[model samples]
Target: MNTHPAPATRETGGAIAPHLRRLLEFVEPDRDDVCLDVARGRGPMPAALGPQVRHLTAVDAMPAHAPGGHGASGTNGRMSTVEFGTGPVRIADGDTPPAAATREERRPHPLGPDRTLVKADASALPYRDNAFSLVTARFSLYNLGDPEHVLRELLRVCRPGGRVVIADLVRGNLTGPDRDRIERLRDPDHPGTPSIARLTEMITSAGGSIRRLDVFTVERPVEPWLAGSCDDATADRVRRALIDEVDGGPRTGAKPRIIGGELWFTQSWAHVAAEPIP
Candidate 1:
């Protein structure tokens, strides 16, 4: 099975930063409102999101992997978890050890008293019904057991007319061969990402109205792409396959396009904003 190294924490953050910024503009949270960043990996969004809203609550299913660390077994050491909130953000640190105990802690952003970190599942949020005015999930739904169910839960927790925005990678966004290889190698635990059409249908069926939907594509150099995944033999195979495909020829209608400094790979993405029905 083909495999790639998990993206470096920095690259992961960079990959999603532009997308998150665009979504934030559309969501437009006010200083008096509470916003929740569900499945917040490494607290990247919260760093930008904390100052915009009155309070920002960040939660993850598992404690973020210690930065620069290796594996789930803590072989490379642990990273620090920093809380950033306006009026006391409540953080829930699920099953992972507290950030303090980890050996590889990154310094917390100085956002001050309003942030709370919690260990929680998106489908079964611990907050009260209608506790938040806005909810955002960044590239997380694709990994959940039931993304639609989580969307319903996101809708349920939002106050009437509040908005829930979802940002995720779409299936057609990656290089064609790379995309196929990924699907073949992907574990069952990693559910395939949903297409834009399905996501829209799920949100509408859940009694939420889509206010805006947009797609953005980015092309990255091959080196960075190869560097992003695991460094194992399987990962090497996958990387080679990707390179061969790119150099071999185009099977999918159009030939590969060159962008920036590398042979281009396309990433199709959609951002959907849904408002709950009153």
Candidate 2:
């Protein structure tokens, strides 16, 4: 098992995938929503939904190791800013200067008063129970190393009757090819994308009741997909495997093909909405 964290499983950048509009429409983030996005890696859920909601809190799984001490004291980690289009979203970079905080200093956040960036483990959020009106996790779940425990924590922080939205690159159809293997080839830390059924089952098991589910496909380019995270040699292997699969090799689940003289493949995604049972 790879102990290091994996890079974004699919595409990078802070932009949300277009197909997610359907899922966002289904849940419909409201201005009254105090949302929490768990395991919100480089995936675009938080950036996509933050503008539509009142306040959004994003949780990153990366460990914060404060160096020599430079951030607010007592903070889980230090603060760093990443531009998410609408505004800059602050994220914890694992260090903070001692809080010398007299009476819990409250300063206006440059990232806007509505956005909050927290540095903590997904399996263990520092928030109180029933704190957020919306708890979501996007493509970042599979990287946590333990999705189940993290799911439970997402439900725990969510207020009863609040919604839990999950969107991810799910596995292919029931009897389809083995997409997981192809993904693992690209990301060694990957633990196989789960099926749609498994995703819903996890939500229910984690104390949330299913409200809606949707599936979509995205045609991904081969070269950039490999270039995003894989080293040269690994990329070559993945390319060969995909090409071989295209040439009657065993099904790799990734439906690789040539389009307009460009190598391409497809990824199946699942967007799920669940509500905590009161």
Candidate whose lDDT is highest: 2
Shift in Å, residue 93, candidate 2: 26
Residue-wise C-alpha lDDT for candidate 1, range 1-278, written one tens digit per residue: 11121232222123433334555655566677699887534545676777778898876643223232110113322111112212211111111111211221244533457878766776777889788988888767654447777788888888875678787766542333445444333222334555667778888887787766665543333344433334456446654555566677434322234444344344455667777876
lDDT of 1 at 163: 72
Q: What is the lDDT of candidate 1?
A: 0.55
lDDT of 2 by residue, 21-84 (tens): 5456655677888998765334345666777889988765542222210111123221122111
Instruction: Assess each prediction's global lDDT (C-alpha) against the native.
Output: 0.55, 0.62
Let me know the TM-score candidate 1 reaches against the reference structure: 0.68
Q: What residue pairs clash in candidate 2, if any at all?
A: 64-94, 65-94, 66-94, 66-95, 70-96, 70-97, 71-96, 71-97, 73-99, 78-95
TM-score of 2: 0.73
